[model samples]
Target: MEETISLKENYEIVKKRIWLILSITIIAALISALVSLFVLTPIYQSSTQILVNNSESEISGFDINDIRTNTELISTYSVIIKSPAILDIVIEELELNRSSGVLSSQINVKPENNSQVVSIIVQDANPTLAAEIANTIARVFKTEIVALMNVDNVSVLAEATVSEKPSPIKPNPTLNIAIAIVVGLMSGVGLSFLLEYLDNTVKTEQDVEKLLELPVLGSISQIKEQEENAFVSSQQNQPVGSVTIES
Candidate 1:
């Protein structure tokens, strides 16, 4: 016959194995903490902003409608800021060893909604290098656009500064360790139940009765003192053809 266990019993089993759960959780948390703090390298970020104003000016000698049209082309300018034409010049001028494509990937350009202002953000391990790259890209883009499109509306709005305190944007150790602890606790509980299921030893009278399907007349305790005494008396007495001992 199948047996049913109560919620209380299940809770008891987990309670009995709480130590295993705690041990696994502690180990996982330690590993995660060590990996996050020591094994992984921390990365820093810096950003620069550029303004894209297409308003016609007296010095530029461009028509108001042409200025408006150029203003609408801010999206195109954002894309061009990261293109090979601009990035290549910036790389050559700065003597950067990275390729145009690789350098471009480090840049993110976005224009303000319904406005002509474009913001360029650069990220690198070194804050000064990041700011230099951002400023260079903006200057190069501005010069190239002025000559190529006959428009001089693009300008640098802000420059990135070196942060006094390191800005950590990735590899959150606390969050990682928290998740690892939860996962480890769950795994430990699952393993405990699995081991319990695989165990086949009879640990209680109920188990013996159920397995044998027979009534138990009586149960007696085997006393160690009585057993020892009986063993000693048997050795002292010599046996005849048939031997018997009284208890």
Candidate 2:
């Protein structure tokens, strides 16, 4: 059977150090919020989709061969979109100071499974630049594929538009704070248990009996300072005409 803690023991543990636990949790959440808000760079993402089917030829019936061929070719198209062939041209056109390698790292080409549509997603610090890059990548890939592979089937299905107010897709503040709270709570509880375990000084008569493995015959009552001083004064007064009065 799994070991279980009594409710009273759990309550005592929590009550003993509730302030420490709350302080740690609140501090952790605040730190996480601050990091998400100001410390880390916010990355804005924009996406554009490209359709890799015959735009010229319109068919009424579904062609399995063409569908399979289009889906299979989309994988190669994904690689070509990120290759230096297209990215280098895009860099020159955009006049971006970054290298093709750096730009490639920020771009992601994701193709839908068993579909001819490919999504070109760009992430940048500037929201407008991210949207421009996404659109430019799709436009550049369309132009380059015809020259590189003599293929003209690829076309931009939807152009990327810049948002007036774009939010970052990374470093989610709420999620980060939630995770920090859990981490802080665990750390606080673990530290509390560690401190409890390390504390071994006896505090009760039962502890003395348990350690000595003998019955505790008696325990000395703790004497207050006032009572001790009175006893000493009475002893001094006994030599100078004093009478004892037992309570």
Candidate 3:
């Protein structure tokens, strides 16, 4: 015969270990909150906007073809901006001790859609350094592109600035705690079920019936120490019976 478990049985299993489940979940959330608050490093991000414009457009007036050309060149500009050709100068100018490969990993270049504007984004542990790196990268790219591509159109539109109260872009404690809670709850439930399955001792009539596959004829009630002592005292306090003989 196929065996099956009802919803009541599942509820009972979870109820039996409710405290264990709750303890594990609470501990997991607390650990996650602590790590997010103190253990993980906060990474701050800064971005600088650079515009790719046709210098001749100012003299010769605006043209759609020039705009399209500048927009198309943005893809190439993005690559060059991250290449050693540009980052090397940026590092040297800023006197950064890190190598180009490491610095390049921290930088991201993105071009605005259908526009001749490119954004240089950098992330660092220090907010001030993040802003400084972003601005330095834009400046270095603008100067070097003129020499490398023979174009004098690139200009810094907005420089990255550090706010008085800059917030880190990641390590959100709320999100981490939320995820930890879910994971912990799932783990607790799984462990609860596992422990229930591994336990073979029968503590209830249902367990005995299930294990033996037989109906119970009777069961003995368990008496506590206090109840047993009370029974003995009542028996001793009873008057001794005297037998009377008929004369």
What would the per-residue lDDT of candidate 1 be over residues 1-247, giving only the tens digit for each residue? Answer: 1334666666777898999989999999999999988998765666777776653554556467765775678778877888899999999998999999898888888766756677788877676788788888888887899877787777778877776776666578989999999999999999888887787898766667878988767776567998889887877786656566569
Score candidate 3 by TM-score against the native.
0.87
Please provide, for model 3 over 101-211, each residue's C-alpha lDDT reduced to its tens digit, 9 standing for 90 to 100: 999999999887768989999999999999999998888888888789888889999999999999999899999999999999999999999999999999988888999
Clashes of 3: 0
Model 3 regions lying over 4 Å from their true place:
1-5, 57-59, 238-247
Clashes in model 2: which pairs? Answer: none
- Candidate with the larger lDDT of 1 and 2: 2
Q: Clashes in each model (backbone N, CA, C under 3 Å)?
A: 0, 0, 0
lDDT of each: 0.79, 0.88, 0.91
Off by over 4 Å in 2: 1-11, 55-62, 215-247
| RMSD to true structure for each model, in Å | 7.0, 4.3, 4.8
**TM-score ranking from best candidate downward:** 3, 2, 1
How should the candidates be ordered by lDDT, best one leading? 3, 2, 1
Best by lDDT: 3
> What tens-digit string does per-residue lDDT give for candidate 2 at 9-57?
5667778988888898999999999999999999989999999986355
